[model samples]
Target: MMSKIISENKVAQVAKLIDKAKNIVIVCHIAPDGDAIGSSLGMYHFLNALDKMTTVVIPDAMPDNLLFLKGTKEILNYSKYPEFAGELIEKADLIFCLDFNALKRLGEKMEVAIASSKARKVMVDHHLDPEGFCDVTISHPEISSTSELVFRLICRMGMFDLFETDSATAIYTGMMTDTGNFTYNSNKSDMYFIIEELIKKGIDKDEIYTKVFNTNTVDKIRLNGYAVSEKLEVFPKHKAAMITLTREELNRYHYRKGDSEGLVNVPLGIENIVFSAFFREEKDFIKVSLRSRGSFPANKVASEHFNGGGHLNAAGGEFYGTMEEIKERFVKILPLYNQYL
Candidate 1:
């Protein structure tokens, strides 16, 4: 569904900006996934190729799973580099935001840096219509991943050959993860073409898959089992399922930060389930992930009830209450879903 309107000029405009800037910084949404990390790193590499002084700053801590990326170690943690990163952002000639539609998603730490930046801010993302928060915006909801947009930007500049193995691996991994391992939202033709390009770069696809999916530790496996067996709750008549995990359970199972990435999708494989939700207790609030099947629009549900939105089939929100309150909210809203079903 990507249109020809996203012309070479648009790509070149961003490239020319990067090529001309003195100091550049990259930022992604908090709780970054592969797309966020990959796009940021890929852009960082491209800018660094032009000898621009660039740094990737994340508002929160980087997940351990993503440390394998080429420049992951260079990602400045907000806690440690807040003042310095803010100073650099304030003085930057340009700033690039990747994978997120809004500045609020960068969280509180980097919010001021973003707001006060004298630099022109450019957004590259694959979400729905944005909030118009940037000087220049390139958004395409139909794209499978922001990493693909990163690849396109580089290729349009005729600098695709400058992509190193680590950069390619990161971008390819993001493409794979965001598309549900190439099974979701990816038309067969485009998926194959992208995979072919990545393969031609000599990326070890099998090894990357193993690292992302099969490299879980024993403790992580146990945590997954505990989450699935103990937390999963189904409302057969309502065709809904919910999985709730508390910090206590996480502690008992030795769960680290990113250990619960794909647990919410488990119940979606079940027949007759119209919607699925996952609730995890974080330090301050409860995180929610919502999924819909068939005709259900989970994004609507999230935005209306849970204060969040994403793709139609998958979305997320956060609540500042106990699990009981969250469950009550969902139960009260079940009748609304009947119309969709």
Candidate 2:
């Protein structure tokens, strides 16, 4: 049985809205991750199956690794085609905001357009402190992923029988990726039950795993090796590990969007290392990814210092500065989190 995380009244209201709406647009956050893409595409496929005019909009370019998912080619990028995305939002009867907590996470232009739209918005996300922007907010930070919440919501609406193979694939991808292939934030038994149901829907778990994880390019592999062998720094006193990469170094490797996907979690393999941080230099800011084991508050570090927040074990934030400056700042902040270590 699905958990009662979403109230029955809210489910009924959402179902009524879905049934009444003719044109539906599903949207996700900026720099879409697997959970964001998976939940959006999963809803797109499901809504299309219901004979609704469905559209999926993304704020920016998605990682190339996610291109293999069904219906991804049909997704409209706001950064690439703002006019069309704006038109869709304007004409949408009901908008389903998936995988993000705030409208700002949709980027400036998209957020403005969405905020100005008359469409009734429903948010389905697993994030902390959701802003009161949507008509119906289905925010549950304790949930594993937005994709899993999507699955539970579908089942709660008595639509499990209508779930198709492609939709199942999308949902499974989100659940798998968000949990790091069932490595963390996946201790619940219901997660496995949902996997069993998706498997019954004809999704090969092993193939999905291979497609997402084992499809790395040679350049990405080389980059990982170099980052680990040379760039990785371990601070044993703080039980932390960090890896910082510059734009020049990335350009040398012909770095792709998802090249550094799992690089943040590598240093946790060390015996006493409970915390890991990966900093990658972007065009104007340094992207931060944090991961920790046990009861360490990775999210606290991200939120208090780096202007970001997420789960306790896995969180991310960004720093606007040079690579050296960000690394120095991180080192300086280590003493504050000494209790967590």
Candidate 3:
């Protein structure tokens, strides 16, 4: 049996909303990671089983690596179909905001639509300091992933009998990827028990791992090699390593969306380094991914400097301006966190 993490009252409130809702839409954060997509899709499947009309709207395109999930094709991308996505939000009777804290995390347009909608909102997430935008907020920073929270929430609602193969696969993917395949933020004994339950649902964990991590293209492999060999910079004094990828270099390698998935974690294998940062140049901003070992608070740096926040060990931020400018900002901020190193 799993421990009860959500309050019974909150569960009842969400249950009532789910029961009353006719048109339900699930939305995840911008730059949807594995957990974001996983929780959204997991909820989508669960809702489908309940015979509710369901739609999954993502702020942007998901990583190519994640398209294998059962319902990826049906997911509405706000970036690609703004009008349709907006219409779905407008028509939704209930909205499940998964894997994100603030309304801003939905990006600009989606945030506006969700905020203005008369639909009741429920937030299921594991991020820090969630904004009070939802009618019922299930925020647990200690949970490994939002997918795990979704699983727990379903069970609490007495809907565990509705768990099926596809929902199990999606939830397992979120738990696996968000923790870097059980590398970090996965120390709880209950996590293994949850995996046991998922396995009982006939989810082949090995196959899911293969599909997510092993199905990388040749270009992705080359991109990883170039990142480690050419762009990697180790600040031994700070016990930190940084990898930067420019748009031109990404184009050179024919970079796809998920090509740089685990690049930030590669340097942490070194004996002394405790921190790693990856900066990928996007069209308008530099997307920053920060990872750390031990008790280092990567999310603090992300929130304080880079306009982002997440878990302590793993976090991300975004920076505007040239790559060099962001690099300079990183250098300038290193001394503040030197004590943690």
> lDDT of each model, Cα atoms only?
0.83, 0.92, 0.94
TM-score of each: 0.95, 0.98, 0.98
Error of 2 at 126 (Å): 0.7
lDDT per residue, candidate 1, 35-118, as tens digits? Answer: 899889888877777788999988888777767778998888776778887887888889988999987888876887797778
Give me candidate 2's TM-score against the actual structure.
0.98
RMSD of 3: 1.0
Q: Give the winner by lDDT: 2 or 3.
A: 3
How far is each candidate from the true structure, as Cα RMSD in Å?
1.9, 1.0, 1.0
Inter-residue clash pairs, candidate 1:
none
Per-residue CA lDDT of model 3 for 112-142, tens digit only, reads: 9999999999999988899999999999998
Which residue window of length 10 is worst by lDDT in model 1?
1-10
Residue 124 shift from truth in candidate 3, angstroms: 0.2
* Model 1, global lDDT: 0.83
